[model samples]
Target chain A: MSDNISSSRLTDIDGWGRSESLRSIARRSFQFFYDNYFRVEWEGLEKIPDDGGALLVSNHAGAIPMDAPIIMHGVEQHLGRPVYGLADHFFRQIPVVGTMWSRLGGVPAHPDNAYRLLRDEHQLALVFPEGTKGTSKVFTQRYRLRRFGRGGFVEIAMKAGVPVIPIAVVGSEETMPILFKINSLAKATGLPYFPITANWLMFGPILGTAISLPAKFKLRVLDPVHFNVPPDQDRYSKSRIMDESESIRLTIQENLYDMLAHRGNPWLG
Target chain B: MGRRVLLTGLGTFWGGKVAQSLEKHPDVDVIVGMDVTEPIVELERTEYVRADETYSILSRIVDATQVDTIVHTFLVVDSTQMKTKRLHEINVIGTMNLLAAAGCAGTPVRRVVVKSSGMVYGCTGRDPLWFLEETPRTDPPETTIEDSLVSAEGYLRDFAQDNPHVSVTLLRFSNVLGNDISTPFTETLSRGIAPSIFGFDPQLQFIDEDDVVSAIEFATSANVPGIYNVAGDGLIPWSEVAKICGASNLPLPPFGTEAAASILRKMGLVKFPPEILQLLRFGRGIDNSRFKDLGFSYKYSSLGAVERFAKTKRLSKAIGIPRSPYTYDKDVESFFHHSPSVVRSTQSDSTSDTF
Candidate 1:
């Protein structure tokens, strides 16, 4: 296996490069995308620290994964710190897409991978602790945070002892409204679940192209909540670790759910 | 003959220190320490009376003891019991009782020194202005139960005017700090902790314990019947104070008054006797030019008292010097060291999970 493909190894991105002109270019590019393509609105940016290693956990929305990118761009523009996403395995399989993902500092989604990255490197790790269940949830279960399975992110954080920052992204699901889910097709394809959205059936067959509606995205970063894990728990059993992790995961998820409910509409003034 | 002086609220941290100082005074004939607690000190004239500082109990104590000269040092720092009824009971009614008893018994009470906080200025909303003795008390909206302090000053002023024989001296003190046996600011400072500061720019003045006692003594001897600002010489910013004390200066975001309330709630440090919070947040500096004219001198006149007292007590172990408390967390330290590498791996892992 190539050194680049090593499980524990990480390829550094030039996101935090100090080339002033390049930085300005990146800023202008982000601004252009924000102004023309999608109008981005952010709230509670002050809660995210200017410089710190934080764990950003958000409820996954939009089957196409628009929430994560919007959050990353929002945080990056506001705090001037490059946000790195913890991506799943399929993205790395695609040729051109995989290389772009590597450059963007996309790590593997395994628990061991998260633990290694968080412990070895101090960069911000953005995760959807709700997993596929949240992203694949039907439109009927709108805005409700799914059961975050025994939060591995929380356990990794507890072991790493970093602050967990709960974030909420609005308007992503509205961009591509999911109509229903085909369980048999999802099972046959070995995917988490297939989302049958308004665009999914009409865009490909009738229009011969996929087009997502332009929705105003609002991203909010909540105050960093630090976990005080006991030092003696280093030698504790896996069950204890899992229990502790799940507690933190649920707390962050609940807070995100509440914040989304309170925020009302991201697009409205 | 040493003059007989009645010191109320002698059980409190500040009151106890004053009681100790009065006991050491060569000319103080008797230091009748009146407190709700059992008497611990056994000095010849240092007696502790087990009575509450209420209208009835104080009247009885004054009558029984024939206490003519009263040093009104009694104060409650507990915010919970700073209600109107409670404040009136202790501050207004209690002072009335002592004055009435002094009048009935014909004890020839010449001077009554009342210790008040400079917090009566209501330091919020107003532009930065030096407060003089004549600054009118402005009522602040929504304060802790101890906020009745602004009204108490009016009572003191009125009483001083009414009583021809008895002279009332009001010493408006800044934040009082020193070797307080009970509520020691030094102890908290030594432990590398600070009472959560609500705002970014916290301008504060502090009077030392010794200075407070000296001021009271000055008031007693001198024929002054007006308000005086009894604070230290210099002012210090809250950020600098945190640095000197070796604690983290956490800036509370400007959430307006709600944020301030939240901080006080979270920290659980908002304990001041009834009517003190209004004066605390609103009231400004009490002009001490009058007291200075009467030849009063202070030993420690800066909020740097924490550093000075800490050095004296050899409390280096409590406050971590050279090394900060942030280094205590290994994960935090590791994160700082390898932040870039960690971000990359986490991102890749997340991407791989999607496929």
Candidate 2:
């Protein structure tokens, strides 16, 4: 594009998701942690298509849900295209995090917004179907996948006619390994659960168990599953969509198990 | 077919302008202007009739003139001119009176074009990015002005349904900004320090003043009959708009804005209503494709309209510093080049320099 045309197009952007200036700043800030702290070793970088829309379905973990950002950063670093993550409605209710998430290209996981991102903008979208259930699991249940919510992601991908790329990250489950969930305290604090973890209990208040263990992250991008149907086809009924969603869930779960068996230690990738 | 038009709200700028334009139109044979106040502008052929909305004179004028089109441009946008309650009366009650008079049995009015506002789509935390023409009206509107507009729309919907013969075109215009027009939105922008809710930059849409007139003209002339969202081409964030207007921002927390609103109201700087605050926090944008499809296009985009409005001498006082001729990005680029470090390097070795 000519410089004049590109500059005019830049001005036309209404600062919705992915503000060029703010995204660059946020990318630099997050890159520090991704490179130094977790030291993420990502595989299947070539699985992502160069252009058009794609959906990344990953398992949710870590009490704070850092997997999405890690995946977002990894894809952006490798593919030169920013990935918009679908945050739960709860994120939008919070004061600062909600606004920050929006500015950082995290759209609330509403059907309207999802459709807009996937179909209208033709941008990659990341969704964690396991939700809080997968994140707040106890230590015994770590690496064991939770039930994917109603397969909304499948319906969305079907409607938008985008390929579903299942992603499996091995290390996030060890970040803030919860011993047990205290539902009573969780109710009082308005959080999903109050997790009692080793580092959190050991380290006292303020800097307590909130600190995530420096676990080496190993992320694998699985093969892209295309429906091979018409973009506007309604043949993929609700049940069919649910079944496809379950199959995608199973694919991620099997990959998690395979990754855990092959890995020597969780701390060392 | 030629039109015998009855133009309401002749005293206001839009009313006078519409009446003056209609007077010159070859298709329009008779122009009857109705308002309690006289027209502000000079007109040769237009007939000015003085009457309150509640009086029977409106119905009598409709019956006597046999006007086929009634252009209702009487919506009150600025609350500074009249008390809120009186503005409500002029807006809601006045609309009711005119609709009742025009839609009466055996009335000669076959078409009605009422200028509603986009404020009916309330600016809230849960608003869609762009409201379409078919978007449901905001129930129990966020502000008193919105409530009046909603009520007027409800009445229009009912009238359209009841009187199938009459074509009622509801023009839901975005916040209008023009050289001559002075609304609360314009005043807010022209303030010394425009206050916005901190950390929230809502996307706002605007319509040029001339475009509003042209839209009115289109509605009055064309056979299009439906609710339409009338706005300019693009949307701009309120912060970017503030930058364009050369006005500094005074960011206040959501809870703290109320006190600042009181101060603004006390100083007569703004009509700082809750809706305005909400609008500042979550600005409104609407889709105007349907209006374009109706064969009318806007002359200016939202930012262009605001830029034109900002150039007026009346707003120049509030805009103490004139907007830079260069774009914001260009200014940023020059700022780095002119900085001490870059300036020293470029001044010393001008050959291989990339700042």
Candidate that scores best on DockQ? 2
TM-score per candidate: 0.46, 0.82
A1-269: candidate 1 lDDT, tens digit per residue: 12221111011223211123443455577677676666777667788777656778887877676777677767777777766677665554343454345344555465544554455456677888777877777777777777766666766777666777877677776666677888999989866777777676667634422555566776666667776765214444568656755665566466656656776554441
Across B1-355, the per-residue lDDT of candidate 2 in tens digits comes to: 6689999888788998887667556677778888888667655456778888554578888888899999999888655667779888888888888889888989888999999888888765555567777766444675678788888888899889989999999999998887567777676676645677776666788888999999998899898899999998877877777776667887767666778777868977656577677777667678898889868877888877877765663445646555423322434434553555553432223223221
Task: State which candidate has the highest TM-score.
Answer: 2
Q: Supply the DockQ value of model 2.
A: 0.10
Q: In candidate 1, what are the lDDT values of residues B188-279, reduced to their tens digit?
A: 45455554324333335667667888787778766788778888765554445556556554333333444564555467643332233222
Q: Comparing to the true complex, what docking class would candidate 2 get?
A: incorrect
Report how far residue B152 has shifted in candidate 2, in Å: 2.0
Q: Indicate the residue-level lDDT of A3 in model 1.
A: 20
TM-score, structure 2 vs. true: 0.82
Name the 10 consecutive residues with the lowest summed lDDT in model 1 chain B: B346-355
